[model samples]
Target chain A: MASMTMIPADCSSSTAATTRLLPMSCHKGKALHFSRWVSLSNRLTASSFPSLSFKARASSPLISAKIVIENAAKVIDGKEVAKQIRKEIAVEISRMKDAIGVVPGLAVILVGDRKDSATYVCNKKKACEAVGINSFEVHVPENSTEQELLDSISKFNEDPSVHGILVQLPLPSHMNEEKILNAVGIEKDVDGFHPLNIGRLAMRGREPLFVPCTPKGCIELLHRYGIEIKGKRAVVIGRSNIVGMPAALLLQREDATVTIVHSRTKNPEDIIKQADIVISAVGQANMVRGSWLKPGAVVIDVGINPVEDAESPRGYRLIGDVCYEEAIEVASAVTPVPGGVGPMTIAMLLSNTLSSAKRVHNFR
Target chain B: MASMTMIPADCSSSTAATTRLLPMSCHKGKALHFSRWVSLSNRLTASSFPSLSFKARASSPLISAKIVIENAAKVIDGKEVAKQIRKEIAVEISRMKDAIGVVPGLAVILVGDRKDSATYVCNKKKACEAVGINSFEVHVPENSTEQELLDSISKFNEDPSVHGILVQLPLPSHMNEEKILNAVGIEKDVDGFHPLNIGRLAMRGREPLFVPCTPKGCIELLHRYGIEIKGKRAVVIGRSNIVGMPAALLLQREDATVTIVHSRTKNPEDIIKQADIVISAVGQANMVRGSWLKPGAVVIDVGINPVEDAESPRGYRLIGDVCYEEAIEVASAVTPVPGGVGPMTIAMLLSNTLSSAKRVHNFR
Candidate 1:
């Protein structure tokens, strides 16, 4: 295993610090040598990495090579893992269809003209088709009443063909999100936003009918990678109901001692440094730095934050809550921003749909 | 303020370590000095207290004076607090009754003839009568069917006079606890064991109809004492559904950075040392020692474990999960075992009943 060594190089500019990596050994028949210019303002205190010192080497203008050995973190390819899951789901669906003459169905209800929501819904429909699951769609105008949306959910609840029902979020501000989400029958709540489902998830000895997709996807990645969770220290950044809170609960359920760091938390970096596993879902671009991680810690980044990018066609590029460049050198394993937890959300939704159908039909 | 100083004294016996306290300045015109014999086996490492060294002083047989200054933690008298709360609740109930001509009523169903359960039920009834709230009781044999219990719950659910219904736990092995708990109306779930209530408690911006009594009491003690919770580090030392789990959720809801330490947690003392507040619900007697706490931490001990005491009329006496003798010298404030969380549980139950009546009748 070839390791990368980071050496702090004296920089002429005071605002920026440069770190140079000298060629050491070959990995995959390729020599590595590079220099990185990091802004001093964004540099987190190196308290977590006590062995490595990045203090200014302004006294020595020449090569002041300080060997800071770093191991390249194994990249958790969510796209590939999600594809594997989809294939497994397809096999189950085909088998169930042959035995019971039934296929899982997912219903998507969209009430607004938002472009992003439309794109997400479209992708979900295509994913369903690829996995041999039937897809149902209903689009209502933004001016539609809450009663109309509730009626749609009620109709879907009565329809046995639709195993799962998901209403696109960020509904019209006038609509009561809780009321509308609660209206979805718990059995068909694939999105799993209902209070009853969440309650079950929080209670010990009780199982939720459906786990929320994003957090469930995060845990699935850990399991698929064969990471041990029991008796390990895990820290979850952000406490949003959708991702962070449920993710912490899931980790605790798996017997990992869990701590939740939120906006109100003080010295979060110190807490993050102690975790054997870290899951960040704060939706902040590159908020977690390499210095905040414990060496060999597994990191699951659920954030998909967009940063302004002049080179991109859309003038913006997506990044995770973790600084990828720094994390690759420190963590034992990490999930990439766009291709990591993002793809797994939809995949888990489909899995929930399939499970719901099987449960309803008493299929193994 | 008078401070206590602990000095390690050489003991003749190798198995036991003795700590002697020299007389310091008077507090309330009373001089305090004492010697305590602590078992070496139960001694936790003094890593949290770097300043204090408890290493064996076997070399010196006489008094080797090493003054370790310790602040005496204020004793939180739960019986007094509960009494004050009962008075406040009584005033509210009288005002509501005069304004709307309606009184709150609590109905309790006891399934078995367990002596402890009988005492608890009788105490609850007397508490309700003392506060001018109507109390209803149902006693059933151990051989009673689950349907019979469900029928009692159903009757209480439809009764306008009954604002809250409680089913004593540890029902006969034949009964399903979850089903019976779920049967209680959400609005009247004064015990707050219903998953829906717990789910609401876990979620942000959503309030449960009633918070679980014991955990609610713990938070109340903090609030009543004017202890700040926001942005503070809090540690909960268990994850039982009844107390520890709900306590952690409640602490998080109040914006305290929360960490849960369970049996699977490694080096629990290290984690507990970082908390500004600690709540321990594990039933093991004296599991948390002074060395496990950070100086000035506020501790709430919820365990009521019975230990042998030959001097008492009863062969056993109750103690808390924390080592009270050690905690009183280290913590800023602490709740005693019997006089602390025990009284607050019943008080919160009564409070929940009153709140239910006010909510159902639309009486502010």
Candidate 2:
């Protein structure tokens, strides 16, 4: 097992300088290195930890994913389980298409390109195609006005082909993210990232048409892995509304005691050690080390960061916030980064798109 | 300290359930409970808890209203604080009346024949008169049609002076809460318990004009007490959207490592013992005990339950989920049942009403 070259010391996540600018150093120790982990847009942070996802120690075959996959088979099979879900969605989409002549359509709008957003969009498009749904894409320049972006949203809002509309996040800074995202009509909000959908998702009794993709992916991973969410001590390390917030809510809804830790939380690593399930959504790569994970805890890493990797042809590879090397040895079961939440997110987006199409086309 | 009685012997609210429920409990618990709570309009289940509020405990010194009141002096004198707020609203109302011949009016529609609802309506009316705001009450028979209720909401929605309209909750068993609540136009939804308000409350960069009164009242108390919410480990017990859900969101917005525990949560009592601050909104009398609270954590008890009390002339006394008798001895600060959150709830409702009027008239 290649010992995770990534250590806890690798990341001195920059201090959170925004907002109230709270100093939580009193929480752990007073080594006050401000973390610039927060960015104007990008959240993807870990690249070097990419290979660690499947094989923890490059030298230790005992901790490799092949064994973890065999152990997890007694509980869940992610690939087969995901296949079953996609199949159900496909059947549903076909049923909707035959009934209303409406192939559930998902229009993904990508504005100004980040590589990660491009990859996500491409995967979403491919997922739609795989599920027998229509996929539409509109690539607008990075300097697009809020009005222009809204106009595009309006077009999708009116397009009967568009059952679910998703705009790849981290939109160019000049574009107001809130304004553009909110413009996607609630009925067509497949990403489930819109406030309206989020509100419905957060509230009781009201069901959201679309649950946010990442959290949805996390839950699907747990379900297929047979990781029980009810009555568990689950700690989510992140506070972004799109992932951490909804993930906490979803966990709570299942009757788990959910704690959301962020840059402001006191002794975050200590808090993570208490969880029976630890979900690290913070974008800082390798922030959640093996010591932070409770032994035998289920680990779901939602981060996909690009770290400098000279050995790779692309010069960088993706990794999760969790240090996979340490986590696999300590965790009873864990989801590997690229093949873990990544695929599940795209799958859920497709499912949401099909669900939205079914709702709009009135196909029961 | 009094020993806390466990609900279900098999419920390891301390560990087993906590592990299994951390993910699904929060999102599902509240909605399911809200649905069950509101569905009584359709049918009553023996399983549902009583609607007895926390205010009735005012007469019991064991509940320690004065002690909470005493400690709260640094932050607020509720009586004085509430009086000052009312005075501000009165002055605003008088100014509006003289300048525009407009006074803020609140219309409350009471459905069915619940004496408690009648008493609550009476208290509200008195509060309105005390604040110089016009109060209108409409009592309807238990068998009122859904359309009739919708029509009333529509009428209030269009009414000019009636800036805020609240249909008393726990509406008749025959009404669909979502439909009925949604009918109360978002602008006039002063209670802030509406799904839209809950959603807006949940999101960042989006603030709801009116936060649900009880949760907002809790925040007001903390704010008045000069308690810093940012970067705290705050645990919210119960998952009701009206109180717990909104409270957690508000706390998180302030950057708390927020955790929500409920019926299915494993070892919830143990989970809560880790909080720096605990807000219990589970509506169970004395569910949160001193042992469950961190030594000096601030305790905000939102439960207002009626328990059999022979000493009281009413034959019942109201108690909060936190055993005030024990919490005060352990917690550095805590809210008592009667005077603590009770006065604040109505106070906030009045404040919200004025806020809605101000928003409508651009008074601020």
Candidate 3:
């Protein structure tokens, strides 16, 4: 896998800013909030190689990288689109609260103390607040028993005030994810990762209560951009349940001929090259090169990996599973790592919470 | 669709009657099940097509379909395969009862009374008895309340003796199928049509407790016949929740690049012709013409339709969704109607019942 030049952290400028939404006694700056603020600079290799310096160029009037930035940049702009959706949701939330005595509530359980999981939980909470939704955060220790977790679920199930429930993933290895998840009643499964909802989504003539968040975000990007899905050949690289698998089903449901390419799949790039639409969710950073994307193909990169960055104080920067540099030149549109699918997840989660509230209240 | 010929009610000397399994209630005489039965004659049409037949011929002497014979037979013997599965299940049931004081119990609920639904219900009961599985039948009028149905389900759910639950499908339009089916707790969902289970099946890493019966039956035939599934391109027609949808997921789970064609899909025939394996569950008789199949493609037809036939006493003949006459010439292997996927459904249902019992008991 090609590596990117380490970008220097502009830490001096970023002061400790407090976001008023988090009134909780405990919590830090939004952790999982995708911070893929890539800037275009002649300050280039002053950052590392395989250089990621060009990944996220600001939305300027000048379509800079006029030659280098073609497909990857054009394929998608998840951050901008996600921000738009978040704004729309904010309006919707304000309307709900003003018109009806109701506020969407999301209860998230963070089991054990995996740094990544913790970061994800934190970002989710912050994102929840930004949309005017209330978030109930529960931190369970690593040694928590199945019964204890199940008990917490029961509490959430009865808490009519909580409209959606999300158990931050990668629970302790000993924990049975399925059992804990099944404990969440179907009505409040806002993540839409439940088997029942999945089945409905996978099958014909049935709609899931909520599409799986990441995949849902991908489809939303397409819909917002008015990309026609029907009769399109969509190739999804990776087959993870959370992303690849559900993404393929979602695309297929929209009438795309979806071929899911996994680790065992032979010729992933060849398969990808044939696609009119490509969604790379495999966690391999910089794996999909520009050559892999067909010109004019729409791309949704769902990977968020930490890569080494000597210039940044954190010693590393976040990059996507796909190699966006060459990709931007080939694909018609694409989403950047930090700003793309990253922000979309929380936005979708908020949307789902709002939706859960709507359904619970029979708000049509 | 081929027409059915009827011998006089008492004229049991005809070939189909001699070879077909008699109903469990009429099994006073030793009878060969679907697989073991010999095919006296599978020809009812002109001999232009090659590989299709209504039943699997069991005579050792008829090892392979002779070019002449293949040219004549236009059926895919689902009835025969289904018969074999039931006999196999019956033997296993007997063994379980003898060793563990356990008898698989399947409870079926029928609401409102569609004539076709009634016939299916009756057939399921007979199939259960034949397989040595106990059957519990319940009938509710069309006007029954959702609560009343839920109460009955609760009763069944609480009944330790009841191992599986199947609500006969095509319930009154007023009844909410999703609510009713989801009410059947996942553990007792014997038909494997439960949304939760279906969702698991669709997710890449997740496996359902039990695959839906008809789709399971289709796979069973492939397994019994030693058909290779991994790394094959399989096309599934129709997208109905009951069959086409789940069937495609099951196939994809088995490593096939599955492309699903639904009612809204255009150029389905062209899509299907590209498959190494084709499973059509659309329920439209003869909708899939022989020309639609690629040469040497393996076909599993899950459609059991009753087409009008003036010559038969019932004034109708059982036909499949495939154009058997033309398909036989093109397909390397194909399922036959009357005896094809129809029989497998009941066998799988029985198998699912046993599976449910084992799961509930946590029997390894």
Candidate 4:
């Protein structure tokens, strides 16, 4: 384990002042509330690394020697794990084909001409092909009517070959997203964005027909790594419906004491510091610093923010929510920015598709 | 405000022993966990009031004199609150009828002949009449096939006048409950048991068409009492589909830092003692005691367990999960068993019916 360093008190003073300004009152014995507030206040005071003076000490021989003393945290290797899962899915697909003469099929409905949306659809199509699952694609013009999109969904809904349906998000501004998403048959909702699937996920004792892909991937990573979630404290930062909210519910279902830290959370760092597992989906680049983490905590960073990099040919570099250099020292293990969570999303989508096909065909 | 009494430490030793025997570890600071454990351990240790020498004290005038020093807690007066809400609902019903010439209609489908189920249906019918809403009832025989029940639901689903539909729970052992519940149109699901409604409730920005009655009633009581939920620490006991799970999700929606303690949770008392507000829906009688509460915590007890009381003609009395007599001394305000959440459930059902009618009619 790498040695943990404590940030200076001066670096955290502003945050302490802001927290004090917030309207929160601790009633009763100051013993419990007072000590807790003090500890949280200490952890949240600094916004960035206190030892960031390394920028000025870059040329110094003494500073360079100090960095050699620390050991790096083990990388989570999400890309490798995702590949292994894809292989397993491939085996299942081949077995289903042999037994029932059926191939798992996924239909992707792309409404607009956004570059990112096109890229995502292409990736999903390729992923389906890689695992021997049939892929169907429907592209509507940017100026297409809502009815046109719904018509495509209806066609997919009635198709016996299509086991799963995914409607790319952020449908044109003129269309109601909920209406379009809800139009997809619940049985074929592979993305699991349908309200019914989300409700089942939140509920206890009721199993959702499909779990949301991204959050499912996060849990799958932890499971594959042999991490024990039962009875542990897990914190999910950011409560976006697609990732954070479902992730928290999934953790709770696994018997972990889960807490969600969103924009309204008074002392997010304090609440986050107590977690045995931390999963951050907030898109802010490098928002989580080493000081915010508990020693030896496992971190899964879902944010993939692009920062300007003049040296790169693309003139940009993608980084996660956690400050990688700092977190590597503080955490026991962590998922790398580009390789982590990204690949797992597609793998989960494939997995949901496979499960849907098995259910439809009554194939084990 | 009631003058609190401190119970003897010896009374709570057994519960403390059980809690200690459970596996729990606070990695860093044991002091915080220890203090919290002490407080919860103190409450759980005592099976009953420490001064249960009441039989012997009745004959002694000096012992009776000591009782005068203690004060009683403020009663929540749920009956009065329920009455007030009914009056408001009645006014709205009359106003809507006068303007639009249409009254809100609620349809209830009850299966089997369980005495308790019959009584609940009767209460719901009476509540609808009290608020001048139309009441429709469908009683299916105990051994009716699933298709027969589905046919009845389809009839109600097509009825334009029916604004809300509630299928009384605990269908025959042979019937599939989820299939029957899902058959009710989401727009008319007043019970809010549908996965879509639950999904909407769990998500951050989505609005549930109807909040689940019991959990909605609990939140309403807190709102009526001017209890602040945002940023407060809340602990919900149990994870039942109907109450505990939804209650925790509702609390989180209200921005309270929520933790759910279920059967699998270790050291539940230690986790619960830190809550500024506690909502317990576990069916166990007297599961939560005075010591488990924070000194000024507000408690909402949803459990209605029946215990034998030979003096009564009915041979039984209803009690809440909390040991009421002890809780009144520890908590700032507490809801009574028969009057507390029971009346609120029907009130919320009426509220949901009215809202559904207004939504369908496009009336404010």
DockQ of each: 0.67, 0.54, 0.35, 0.46
Q: Comparing 2 and 4 by DockQ, which wins?
A: 2
Q: Is the docking of candidate 1 incorrect, acceptable, medium or high quality?
A: medium
Tell me the tens digit of each residue's lDDT in model 2 across A1-364: 1122332223333322211111233211211110122112122222201222323324355444444333221111234445667887888878776776778888889998688788878988887898898889999888878888899889999998788888888878788787788888988888887776777888878888789988987887776544677888899988777888888878877778888889988888888988878787877777787667766677888887777677779676777788665565566666665556766777788888877876766678
Span of ten consecutive residues with least summed lDDT in model 1 chain B: B31-40
Stretches of candidate 3 above 4 Å error? A1-73, A204-207, A267-274, A289-295, A306-318, A321-326, B1-76, B142-154, B204-207, B306-316, B362-364
How well is each residue in A94-159 modelled by candidate 4, as lDDT tens digits? 999999999999999888888788889999999999999999999988899889999999999999
| Regions of model 1 farther than 4 Å from truth | A1-70, B1-70
List the lowest-lDDT window of 10 residues for candidate 4 chain A: A18-27
Ranking by lDDT: 1, 4, 3, 2
lDDT of 3 at A280: 89
Task: Give candidates' CA RMSD values in order.
Answer: 9.4, 13.2, 12.0, 13.1
TM-score to native of every candidate shown:
0.86, 0.79, 0.77, 0.79
lDDT of each: 0.80, 0.71, 0.72, 0.77
The order by descending DockQ is 1, 2, 4, 3
Candidate 2 segments whose C-alpha is farther than 4 A from its true place: A1-84, A98-100, A113-116, B1-80, B95-101
Report lDDT (Cα) of residue A263, candidate 4. 75
lDDT of 1 by residue, A1-364 (tens): 0111221111212223334333324211111111011111122222322222234222253433332333355567677678778988999999999999999999999988988889889999999999999999999789999999999999999999999999998798999998898899999999987878878888998989999999999998888766788999999999988889889999999999999999999999999999989999887667788778887788999977766667779776777878765665567777877778888999999999999999999999
Q: Which is better, 1 or 4, measured by TM-score?
A: 1
